[model samples]
Target: MVSCYSSHGMVRQSWDLFSSMRRSGFPGDGFTFSALLGARASSSCSDHAKLLLLLGISVHGLVIRLGLHLDVVVATALLDMYAKCGRVAEASRVFDAMVLRNTISWNAIIVCYGQHGGGKEAFELFVCMMRDGCCPDELTLSSLLSSCADMAAANEATQLHAYIVKIGFQDFLQVGNALIMAYGRNGFVQEATQMFGMIPNPDLVTWSSMVSSFAYLGLAKSAVHLFDRMLQQGIQPDGVAFLGVLSACSHAGLIEDGFKYILLMMRDYKMDPTPQHLSCLVDLLGRSGRIKDAYDFVVNMPFEADVDVIGAFLGACRMRGNIESAKWAASKLFSLKPNDPVNYLLISNTYAAAGAWSELAKVRSVMRNMCGNKVPGCSWIEIGGIVQTFVSNDMILHQSREMQKMMDLVSLVERYCNDDDIICNDPSLV
Candidate 1:
């Protein structure tokens, strides 16, 4: 009853029933206690989790005080509670104090670590489990593989792949899909493709993974072809599948193809275009300089065009130097997200480029009056097994000093033509 109520978000009712049960002095067993903990954890009430912890601790204290047995099930529930409550440290403490540990205990802790971005710790624990002669089952490998993939540990992922093959789990669809995701995420598109092909009976997830792999690698044409083949093979495309198709079409500048798929999605499949699909379409059309069509589409959209959709159109207008459309898009974007600095910057840049000095001044003045906050630009690079992120105009290691030197060199370049007309007509002539 507690689990059902919690699952349905009826926290008050769950607690009321629990309170009544406690008042009746009915002794709660392990399952009842676990359910109570789950209800408390999933409740929307603030501090419900903390109250649950207190109740659990009290129960545990009573159990120890009364010399009751410390069973693995109770310990696992306790660990799960602590982990879910964002107290992984407490969870680890409980695990350490366990008199008997099982694979479930290990899996819970590993999942907690993965959720908290402690992938390295999870992987290390897996190693320790193996060193202690504990055999990992499919669940264990699945958890480890997910962590490795999220952390982009390609070498570790490859080793796990080898282990899966050795253990005859290579044919397992779930495992193969995970391997595909890992390889694609780590930029090993070729390896991911091979793994996808090796899955003899590919499910929807398998097909989506292959299509997404191409999308991620920017092989948009190949992705489109794969989606076509999937349809030809009678594989029904899900939302994720369409997302890949639309994303591929967007990146490859296949505006016509994207528009076709959007219509096909509604006509043949009766699937409504999600906000993501709409945003992609707007981006596609706007970037292709079909500003009027993009604007009309957004204006006539059945659902509200979210800030993301408007931003997409705005960015596309900026990229194409369509100052008129950019101003219009900016108005919609600013109305939707007034405090978004990127929109303000984009509008200001557009106005300045169009020689609307007064408009540019007004835009910049508005930005200045709106708390003086500006959006910062950032870039990331991965090298030698490490990823480095840097913000614009911020000193980023060796690059900061080198940047000034490059700017100085650019300033000193010889000018072949000083005439504005010639420079505008043919910059390469210089």
Candidate 2:
């Protein structure tokens, strides 16, 4: 009954049954505790992780008391639970203490690090897994590739791709999809295209990844063309695929085509417009200089406008110099994301652009009082297979002195250009 309840995702009921069993002098085994832990992890409540972690810890205590801590299955479940709760360190500790390990154990810990942006650590663990004679399967490679994508480690991803091909896992659907995503995210568009081509029978995920890759690379026509090909091939389009198409249209400013696709999605495909779809529509219209229409669209959206939708509208307002609309959108954004500094920054910039000095000052004052220091804008670039990140006013880089000198030179050039405008009348000189 507890297993049934847990399987059905009735977390509270499962817990109740578990308590009742214990009260009735039924000492459950590892399987029972594992079921309860799985149910706890699957709970969809708002406070999911916090509540799930508490239950997981309790179950872990019970496992230790029952001398089942070394059981592979139970230990794996504990590792997964900790990882899901963002307690990667605790998960690592559990992983290290396990007397017996399996591929599942390694995969769990590697995935934990991968999902949490510890790509380097995940890579190290993969190497250790190889040394420990634990042959990695597709899941292991896919997880590591995903981490590479997150870190924009193109070189690492390429090496992994070579390794996957050598191991004959290149044709595997999941690995192919992960490779496509990793290559695309790392700016290896050609490699992503090749990966897509290598998949003989592409699924919806494959097609979606390829289309999104093109869209992200600003090749909107290619993205749209691929979507058409996908349709012609009789593969059904899901919300994600539609999002790629819509994003492509937005980026390319194909307003009419975007609307047609939206209508097609609704009328023919029976797909409702999600917030992401609405955001793309807003961006499309706004970028095409139809700010009023974009605002109206947001106002009349069937679903409540989320932060992304409002942010899109706010961005449009900023572009079109609609101070009133921008102000209203910023307020909505503030309510939705009170702690987000971008909202305050956008509003302040909009006010400044409109010469509303008093309003700009007020916004700045509010930001200073409520949000404290604004986070510096940061960006990263990959050179020689190493990704280096830089932040505005950063002082931690190894070549900070050289960077400062470059910045000083650029500032000087800007000041000089602004103060004195020299013109050459000779055509040859021009």
Candidate 3:
């Protein structure tokens, strides 16, 4: 009963039930506490993460009191709960305290660090897992690869691929799909295509990744071709695949195809449009100068718009120079994501572009009052198989001299080009 309730996110109910059991003199074991922990871990919403962490910590205390913390299964579940709650330090401490562990235990810890942006720490733990003679399964490889892709750590991804081939796990379809995502994210499209070809049979993820890769590169026609091929092969589509298709068609201003596929996804596939799909549709409509239609669509969404959807609407308003729409979207963002500096900066920039000095000042004032300081913009570039990071106004993080020289060269070169003619003419000749 606890397990069932926990899996469905009824954490409070599970706790009440557990309290009743405890009042009856029933001392819960590892499994009972594990179920409770699983309930808290099931939530993927960031807004509720802190509250869930508090509840999970309470459960951890009970597990320790019952002397069940040493139980491998219970410890693993406890670590997973911490990981899902965004408490990487607590998860690592729990993992290290374990006296015995299995593949699942190791995978849980790896996933904890990997998903939390500690890709290097996660990779080091993978090495430790090998030294301890715990064999890694497909889950381990896929999880680690996912982190590598998120970081665009091409070097690490390549190393993992070699290890996968050495261990003969390269043929696994899931691993193959991960490799495609990693390579594509790292700017190695040829390698991603090669991996895609090696998969004897492509699944939904494989097609989605392929489509997204092309769409990201603005290769809309190629993405459409791939979608057509997937349909010919009779592979079922999912929400994610539609997201890619919508993004691709929107980028190319293929509004008809975007709406056509979205309708097909809803009517034929019986899948509701994800927030990302809605965002893409907004972008498509905006690109085609359908500002009013896009605004109406957003207003009529069955559910409240999430961050992505609102951001997309804001971007469309900015692109079309619709200050009223941009201001409305900005108001939505102020309440939805008050702390994220990106949203504040975007609205301020839009206001500045439209010559709304008072509104721009207000946004900056709100940002100062709410966030205290601007978050330095950060970006990554993979050069010659190595990924380098640079933060705005921080030169010492990488090769400061080389980057400074590049910036100087770009600033000098831009002065010679006419903005009106530059778009259609060769930049080199300009």
Predictions ranked by TM-score, top down? 2, 3, 1
Candidate 1, residue 353: lDDT:
66
List model 1 lDDT by residue over 1-430, tens digit each: 7667756877667767767877899666666666655655565456576776676566556545543426777777778777777788988887788887788888888888887888778888898788867787777787777776677778778889899989888877788888888898778998998998888899888988888878888899989999999999998888889988898888788998998888889998999989898999998887677888888988899988888888888777777778878888888878887877887988887777677889889998898887386757767555554545678677857877887888876664434245566567865655
Query: Could you tell me every candidate's TM-score relative to the true structure?
Result: 0.71, 0.89, 0.85
Per-residue lDDT value at 382 in model 2: 74
lDDT of 2 by residue, 63-149 (tens): 999998889988998998888788899999999999988999999999999999899899999999999999999999999999988
Tell me the deviation in Å of residue 24 in model 1.
Answer: 2.8
Clashes of 1: 0
lDDT of 3 by residue, 1-430 (tens): 8888888888778988999999999988888988988988897777777888888898899888888999999999999998888789999999999999999999999999888888878888999999999999999999899888888898889989999999999999989999988888777889998999999988989999998888877889989999989988999988788888899999999998999999999999899998989999998998888999999989999999988888988888888789999989988998998898888988888888889899899989989989888767789876775567777777586578887899887876675454646645756644
Clashing pairs in 3: none
Alpha-carbon RMSD of each model: 7.8, 4.7, 5.9
Among these predictions, the greatest TM-score belongs to 2
Poorly placed runs, candidate 3 (over 4 Å) = 1-17, 43-52, 300-306, 354-359, 382-387, 398-430
Q: lDDT, candidate 2, residue 254?
A: 95
The per-model lDDT (C-alpha) reads 0.79, 0.90, 0.88
Q: In terms of lDDT, which candidate is strongest? A: 2
